[model samples]
Target: MQATNTLPLDMVYHWEATKADSLYLTQPVGNDQVVEYTWGRAVDEARRMASYLKSLNLPEKSRIGLISKNCAHWIMTDWTIWMAGHISVPLYPTLNAETVNYILNHAECDVLFVGKLDDWEMMKPGVPDSVRCISFPLSPPNDFETWDDIIARCSPLEENVQREPEELATIVYTSGSTGKPKGVMLTFLNMAYAAEGGMEVLKVGSDERMLSYLPLAHVFERTFVELASLYAGFHLFFAESLDTFVEDMQRAQPTLFLSVPRLWVKFQQGVLQKLPQKKLDTLLKIPVVNKLIKKKILKGLGLDKVKLAGSGSAPLAGDVLDWYRNLGLELLEGYGMSENFAYSHINKPGRSRTGYVGENMPGVETKISPEGEILIKSPATMLGYYKDEEKTKETFTEDGFLKTGDVGEIDEAGRLRITGRMKEIFKTSKGKYIAPAPIENQLMANQSIEQVCVSGANQTQPFALVQLAEGVRDKVADEAYRKELETTFSQLVDRVNKTVDPHEQLAFIVVMSDEWTIENNFLTPTLKLKRNVVEDTYEGKINDWYAQRKKVIWQ
Candidate 1:
């Protein structure tokens, strides 16, 4: 293991110079080859940006925000924000205008950094005039000051801008399922402790390689990208674009892979793309082809070289875990919230519980309250919600453990298995409580269904709002074919309903024409369905789906 040198920002260059010199990000620069940056250059850029930030003279702990997608600028901007004395706030780039304005006002931020995004111009109307905006990569509307312009106007590096371990560093706003967004305040010590703990757990070292594809605005990516990669020297490769993600994954062939459950399912779907179910099943009947198929899939996902592959943000299915295990991938599920720096319980390498979210992470203590809420306390937990003392005070018990909102059980082996969100579970007319998650997880295992939201409020039986697999629309565009598919879907609902108890049966199944996405606000950034949106859209229609009671028919 290489020793880490303390700097204002995390550095791959100083600790692992050779690997850092390797091409890290591989994205396009217009029509030319991909614009690549070396770790040495990245560290220097962060320092220069930090120096520029010091020139601004913002008050200590003042809120600063960046609106952008997952890009090289995102990291540089984050480094600069932290390197400065001011606190950092990152917003969802895809947020609606109303939500964006609310967050901007809620944070009371006066200075905002803007970056390249899809339809950025459309959102300009909602930005508060009080906030001064600087464009990143400082592209056009030539009136605004560019990032480089700021750097050029700053004093030279002093070599004395230090970040104390306990200072408030970053504030991340979470789009919670039950309510509007709230800023979660975290200190340098909180992040560093999580990074430090993760390093030991993963046995990460200089030789380890990682691919950064998830949104860095989220806590999981911030810890993994900033802290872990710094302390343990790992080379990073960024995806070129949305169109080039799979090819880029092939090119990077990373050893340490981390993804949310949605991407994990997508990767599995990609594997199945080439090998259709009927054909793959027929080939598995033959001995040699089955072994070869497994090898092919394991290699395709870059998992052939993977030391660890994790599913987090949401629970993955046991059957899905079994399927991945067949291909020689170590699929471990982890559980944590944005409130705790996303590292409370992890399915560590070698010792894994496919059903459980794994044992508590090192130095973190987890206990289930009598009401089945998961309670955790550690240095890694956030200091509190930013400026919301009432909510923060309510987040903890009298003994000072943070309430996780998740309903879970700890087994004899001390592994945590989350059953459902306490609020999401609903009671049926028969008085039997239905846990939506397990049913939804099982429904998702079917490749045809993309997103499923289960609900049973004031209904005899629970139901699902299903988003279809990608390209399912174009494939079924024909009116006749669409009708046929609707018929087949009803059959599918009947099959699924037969497998469960009477009260738990899916009485309603609606196929969404448009996909549920983070941008659409139907899904949170983490890709979990916003149950409220799904329920709101179908609340009146759910009864309609059941009133017809006609199988083998279109709506």
Candidate 2:
């Protein structure tokens, strides 16, 4: 019940003995098939793998690379690495060969565990030939040794290995929205503090079910979902693919749910596709029908059972947060980063306010620097960036608070409202600095706008490049639809411009013909816009876009 000082491996061992027969993970294979792992079975497999890893005779605390989409084996492999007295390094599955190569080499990984991924072919070349490779059950065809084969030959490690609290547990790389990713070194204690504190605060019970589709490589999902489940002993489910997401959600019937801002908006748009926003708003006014309609809508999205829903990884629009709340779902927005094990601040159940990521956590301290950057000190704070002491030194203050790099203000109630990224703010030719996030959030209120990147470094005024929503983009070819969209966006820009300072107001909105995606290098693996990449890709067209001078320019 109390916040735990126990490490993650200890929690796994605890569950293995007490909840041995309980269903722990449900991993969906392709074609509606699922493979379930009980606490006993999962631990046994991890032990056998641990024995295999020991046989390899790697150095103590050697870095072991893990590249996988969220899967049962990914969790088990992490356990195996810890049990064998090594450090786990998880790479985002969406990484290109170059980035993958850089991380593995930079970390000096001795082994690489390849698991369920959509882009194995592209990432395979990144694996160093010197490091041994092991493939999970769901991994694509490869010449590497298989997990089942190793488990078949090896015996479960009988010794109950306990890791030191301060021992390095994992290295989670950043999503690289700005530049090359940095390896964040987290200890066992760091992981425990975040997971146990979150579990206790959220009141997660052993009976709770959760779906894990977000990249476990990201600290947000790793600490909150994966590690928290270890402490809470909740049933975790892995999503198979994007196409089967709704079905997978329905199958899990998760009591706890976590999502990012973009997906939350997409879910809203999906609901609007069936029931127009105007009609849904009218229906909600009718009390009796409203309850039924809300329930039905949530059920269709496979989130009717979700009780403790959370939104994080980016700022969710206040309206979108309200939309989910109107359906009687208690949605909370959290704030954290890779440097702190993603355990900074979280909106408490009843104390939540839209547009603000709630008060500092129980053992967390927050203060704004003179320059407007939010600084945090938490029990879960990372040791430092791996092999980058200089950068690590630059990221923290003399008093030990980690510089969050996010500009925000603490309100009277102690809730944190993120204003903008310090690095992301840009100046117009007139020397007026513009914070784009608020304006972008305002622009996103329009259902047609999928993604927006506001930029104008030396230009007279800032402009926005937007990717139209999926359904909206499909209709762009139609002349009537195109005309309607132009008018809608024109009105959107005007409405958004009024909310900002005159200098900060957008000069125009350009609807891009292409979608920004991880594959295209426009978005980070965590789905945040890679501003530099997006800007550089369209640098030459900026002049053309401005020369057009139209309120809504189509590209």
Candidate 3:
């Protein structure tokens, strides 16, 4: 695999099957017809899109807002916007009405492209009256023109485009942790280098099948799915919906895979539900039953053919990864944040590390500061926050290295292991500090626990608030069943405490039930549990969980 500096120099990476032939995406967009296109045809569509943009008489770098789920049309429209020398602003599909308006307004968007949307009309309140909104629906409404109509009206035109490597490609607004969304400005060169770096690392063959289910609007997916696949000739496919993702994967049989920790846990939970943890533990004690159970679990998930699998966006327990390996799937975890265009580091092919994010991607320099926070310099790093000069300045050092908010250690093998978030660390009255995410992930690895929140604030001992799995509803409600849960939880807590530092051990275990969902504002679009919300919601409920002060709090 070549280094980032030596890989792709252009936005689109393609392959040749015949004369001028290349690979592209195939999918159904919300009951829309299944459609497929060759790379050559897609290029033609993009050029036509650019032609329409050239006729708009807009000034250079005029912002264009594009709100859509992942689709081939999304990429075609994105490339078209860049081809016309305009900036692209992509909105997340799962955003609420407030953020839809916020991103369009913040970007000062002059034109909007709406793609095969869900609940689109209800979301229209966010658009400014002055902004001309166009629809890219598979079947556009009578009032607005479909993308095909717009492309047909404009004559086919290609440009002698001139863009510096440092030119801004798109503005990606991250979900707000404090209040409102902040746009992160990413340059074409910054993104291109990162995609190339990932290609250099994974080295998967161009013929590999990739399922593009994650939101392409995200920097992580855009760099890996949109850009990396283009350069590698991988045939990309999209899911019909979340419920049908597994079906699509079986059809596509994707060789390369990526998912957040929570989704992977859901996959594991589904299997374990069929064969409860107690049954699994019992079977594992007997070698014959253990081998048979592992085989059954792997076959059920269709992971038998999964060439590569990995989880990121949150910490995953080492034990979970080991379990997958025992069943013959080598699940490696990687680490990166939005600022690095989401490709700063990844695990190497054969060399796997438990806590460390793999080595820095090619061309990215990394180091640990005196305080142990990770510092990085890469062409892939975001240029800065959009329209927020002060925040941008605060995010970098005097010499321009992006300050990764994580504390970490670098091992002799060059793998980077994250300890905790700098701001997330909480000090106890006993003068010991704790990072909650790792402890929480470990707790959730227990078969019954779905989500876990750990906080100490001003208290002497830290504790966990965990939600039981939905499938365990029967046991969750039964008092006799509840007793068994308490017993299991107490042992789980004791086992965890012996493994970690005395100060970091969880003192109380609270069994909770309300699911952490996007609809309820408890999870990010990427599915990470909202730490702030968890701490805030459970603050009053803490006493209810701690009232008994037993080893486990089961209500």
Candidate 4:
């Protein structure tokens, strides 16, 4: 395989020949059992599967759909698609049947690979009978062809397969925060550029170990964990389930970790439950005790071996970032989008500044438009949206810069700090426009609040609708605790008000009784709040909430 501008398949071939017996993937089965795959064995399985795919005689570049949680066979199937000269389309495991149907038909999929999933019955109706179905070893009982059965019958593809850098590699659909999701078409070159660049910046190598729990359907994990592993030849581990996540993490002892803000906060809350904040703060002040305490906490969370940890996909609370820093962890924040394959910007190891996303990546240029939208031009920019040429043209400026919908500022040191989304800024009836993201971040600093949405679209003043944290909810049922929380939240609002302009100050906070979750469609699969869904759910009660004129009202 040629090394120049290498694609993922090229690196896969390189590792298979040089490190044939090296362990590449570790997958957890049920009941404390695991299966490991070596480089040679894994490629052999992919080769056999590729031969099976080729027998179908699908048209060149035909779309093949993959629906599964992160598992060993998921990666193998992706490689098989490319080797068979087909494009891959991965759907989020949590997507509803309606969305699954929409995506499969929209992509004109010829075949579907169904792997480990929790809700196969619910999603089964989504797969049109016209499309062929293949099942993985871990898949729920179905009549579809099994991976092991196909491998047993077929011979491995003997010739080394190579893909042109400009060929279509994958189509990733957005999480659909507002409306229908659009397919972002990324080429082999786009993925190669991002994976290679990230590997260089992070200094990853074969010695590095990482846990893959984030959805590979999303660009962030696909580019960093899947594609980067191919480039760097690192050991990758799959998380079994939510119940076994801690055990899985411990088994890997990952040298590199990546997480979203919500999971990071949950880890903090879990630690604080074991040791109260006041007592923990006092212990940390002692020079000798602080080191031991930090070590114990990291070890307990199965992160003692983590050399670098990152948070992305949403704005993390500043207070949460500071908490991790105090524990001697170098937690960095980054900024990117699906249009650029998430290769835009990341903080330098020793040069990171708090609250800023960091400087532009290598070979990337960024500029703030006159309207304050962040525009970026990078080596990994997508070819275009899958089939929407008009929308694709509108997304880019005449100079070829992708228009990121985020409004942000660049400092003198070139660090970028995001303010809010352009479409999320809502105007009140009093003719004042308020950006909700910064205010929501401020609200998240309070440990009692789990999720907050600040909306006052046509009202006189902005207000917050918040779901109380899980640990705090049980206590709120008690009369005494409820009154105490009311007082604490009142003071919290006053503090937040003093920091913002008069119009931006919130009128009150509404404690919601209902939970916001992916199952309820209040949050995207990536855990981002769907503002439109949240606002519409409470539109009829906004006037009632304000009529009480209380500092805090419980819904």
The local distance difference test score of model 4 is 0.91
Q: List the residue pairs that clash in candidate 1.
A: none
Among all windows of 10 consecutive residues in model 1, the one with the lowest summed lDDT is: 1-10
Tell me the tens digit of each residue's lDDT in model 2 across 1-555: 233568898888899999899999999888889999999999999999999999999998999999999999999999999999999999999999999999999999999999998889999888889989999999999999999999999999999999988889999989878768899999998899888788767988889999999999999999888997898898999898998898999999989999999999999999898899999999999988999999999999889998899989998888889989988987899999999998989999999998999988778999999999999998789999999999999999999999998999999999999999999999899999988899888888888878999999999999999998888889989999899889888888888888788998889998999889999998888888889998999999989888887999988
Show model 4 residue runs off by greater than 4 Å.
Answer: 1-4
Q: Could you tell me the lDDT of residue 273 within candidate 2? A: 83
Candidate number with the higher TM-score (1 or 3): 3
Clashing pairs in 2: none
- For model 3, the stretches where C-alpha displacement exceeds 4 angstroms are 1-20, 29-33, 138-142, 160-162, 277-299
Comparing 1 with 3 on lDDT, the higher-scoring candidate is 3
Alpha-carbon lDDT, every model: 0.75, 0.91, 0.77, 0.91
Q: Write one digit per residue (lDDT tens) for candidate 3, span 490-535.
A: 8989988998898888878877667788768898777777788888
Which 10 successive residues of model 3 have the least lDDT summed?
11-20
TM-score of candidate 4 on Cα atoms, chains taken together: 0.99
Q: Model 2: which ten-residue window has the lowest total lDDT?
A: 1-10
User: TM-scores, in order shown?
Assistant: 0.91, 0.98, 0.92, 0.99
